[model samples]
Target chain A: MNRGFIYDTFNVVQQNKIMLVYQGEFNQDIAKSVLAMTERNLDFFGEDVSVKRKIFNVMVECLQNICKHAEHSDARLREAIFMIGMDKDTYFVTTGNHIANEHVVGLRSKLQEINQLDKEGLKKMYKGLVSNDKGLSEKGGAGLGLVDLARKSGEKLLYDFSAVDHCDTSFYSLLIKISKNKIIQ
Target chain B: MENLTIKATDDTPEVSFDTSGVMILSGRSLPEDAASFYNPLLQWLSDYGKSGVTNPVVFDMKLEYFNTASSKMLLDLFNELESVAKSGVDALVRWYYPEGDDDMQEAGEEYAELVEIRFEMLTY
Candidate 1:
């Protein structure tokens, strides 16, 4: 019996309750598909409606962020990745995309600032940004998505940047965890 | 003034603004560019403010889901209504959320704190 690489990949993905992965261009249509598919699996698992909503929100933020921010400056930057899985009471959403090096430092600082905040701090920050006209970026960014990601998951964002060879961009990967049992104001 | 009605799509929500002062936004809102999807609504509200609307405005927010970008745009929309309210237009926001959906409920509460118009929290 000779199994191929595709079989190995499929086996790996099927290890947990469900492992959904997508890598390529991320547009609004693809984003829709991702949410629909993830929601079906969540429903199959009989997840609580509220828990499913939290995961859905986090996915929306992550996918929308990728659809808007992932640079297509070159061949390498054309690819983006999204993966989601659940184990026990915790679910994880991980995304990887290429971003311009010029924007890396600013993005890093923003993540650090968000990660330092507790639940209440994140809520206050989100409120402040939404209330102040200048705080919310007109481009639909303004770190609002990142703030919601933290607020919804009630977890610090996990991120890393890797330099790309012979390019002015780097691959940025972010991991966020959501717990079904956790609830905070 | 004519009403503004936008059909809902898989990515965006259904928007209804009536001349009778009943506004509604429901369904999912995950547009690729939330500003493009919402800017026209803001303009419509601005126009409504200028028209000297006499009837009270009842905006029903029955959104099932909205992304962060849309959340910000929604605030702008709310503020536009508040501007109209300041000019003596009676405006109230009815924030509707599914029962047991605390996230949606809390979102309504937060938006209430940001705007001048009164808000009524309702559960569906």
Candidate 2:
């Protein structure tokens, strides 16, 4: 990793009004602290209570996704990255983690499926999953997190995947955007 | 069954179930190990189901936020209650949301549509 590149990225993040960023192992303790910091930051910025709650809900889902699904390999692979930022009236929550390459196809397809649904369709999907006796994955995920994120944000889920060198794993990044103006609708 | 009460934390909700047939769960629920946190509650509900509760059971859910795992556990809880209701025990679910929080309201509505028990939406 180039030292100058890290500095440049820091500069870019600050310029973009990024609220919070973390790159480390995500456990219960870290999740709690990150949530607290995010809450305080939202209050400091005087975001609307409804908007703040939406961002907070999305943050919890993203963090739990990292903790539950991030592929464990070496110490570095165990680490995940999360960032929350705002541009204009829209808030963005993003998370990136290492995942087994074999899992990428299913995960990508899930995201696409969620992105294709409108609000009503997402609601129906959520109810159907919740009522399905066999919906829970082996990881204890009900597979509704992405759908919930999309429904709450009222926006499509954006994602990207890249292969990691010398390993059968890839870095998966997901982004959710919540627009203040569209929230009331 | 004796009443069960678990205080809320940064990531778990406060749970209160009275023998008088009133249940209340409020606050955020984002537990790291959702099974560890919700298993006991599920067991309590199971016991309640067998405890000859003929009185009207009221469930008040005022959750601010919950993760996907918690959502699954919640569904399980509601399913248990639905069975109890079907067995001739009067059961009612009151889902509360903060004024202007459409997502939370929608969450309650979705749960209502999934289970067979009666549900009412309240704004606070």
Candidate 3:
């Protein structure tokens, strides 16, 4: 909110090649606006249809995850962030949000499990779980989105976590890389 | 039974399911409240099941994009239809995805594997 912080954040985004950065609480309307704005940016860049769809699909999962799982209270979670950046032949879709500390271990393990899979393995797992009703809830699946993100991006899931102050919560961040090249390899 | 039609929004797809036979769901489907958006359609399918429409029923899905939550609802929707198909009723799902988009195609393939009803994959 202050000039110094804004200046520092601006420099960081500039250095990172971030196309759009959003840092706030998320709701349905905000999620829609984020998608719309990102769509406009993608169109402005004249991105290919297939690539744009990939970005949008990842963005939807990330944003909805924030809405569904983030502990919204001030004591529990705060300042969720989402951003997309590009460098050379790769695009980065990143999200950071505060989650209850109790939930962090489960999510981290799930993501680690997803990161371990090769593309073929990921596909098989996705197909296997796509039918199972255990994690397939109305809110979202347990590890379904994470697996799908890996399958679509054809890259490892990059993620990190750090403890938050004054509460039993952790700030979890994930970065997904999508290659612009037609072939994944 | 009454027909069902829902207008599309930026976050939800348009749904047009008729008792006359063809059911179509198209456009984007990433609604935050997927349950609220899709429950009525599920209810309609239940009603259609009871009405016993002997004619062939085709469920056409033409979604451009949907999030994980909407994807689950889709599975629920397909499962409901599977029951209708099992009870001596003719039912099929025409899953259409844009050509060259392997992700959506693979998604359809996964869904096709789960349900017993006849499923078709066609590229637009």
Docking class of 2: medium
- On lDDT, the candidate that comes out on top is 1
Quantify how close model 1 is to the true structure by its C-alpha RMSD in Å: 2.3
Judge candidate 3 at residue B57 and give its lDDT. Answer: 84
Task: Please tell me which model should have the higher lDDT, number 2 or number 3.
Answer: 2
Which digits, one per residue and each the tens of the lDDT, describe model 3 over residues A1-185?
56799889889999999999888887778888888999999899998888888888888887877777766668336678889899998899999998788888898888888888887888788767766767446454444778878887888899999997887888899999988895332
Q: Candidate 2 regions off by >4 Å?
A: A1-9
Candidate 1 matches the true fold with a TM-score of: 0.93
lDDT of 2: 0.87
Predicted structure 2, TM vs. truth: 0.94
Worst 10 residues of 2 chain B by lDDT: B30-39
Task: Put the candidates in DockQ order, highest first.
Answer: 2, 1, 3
TM-score of chain A of 3: 0.90
Residue-level lDDT of model 2, residues A1-185, one tens digit each, is 67899889889998977888999998778988898999998899887898888888888888888878876868889889999999888889999999999999999999988888887899888887877888467777777788888888889999999989998899999989999898745
Cα lDDT, model 1, residue A153: 87
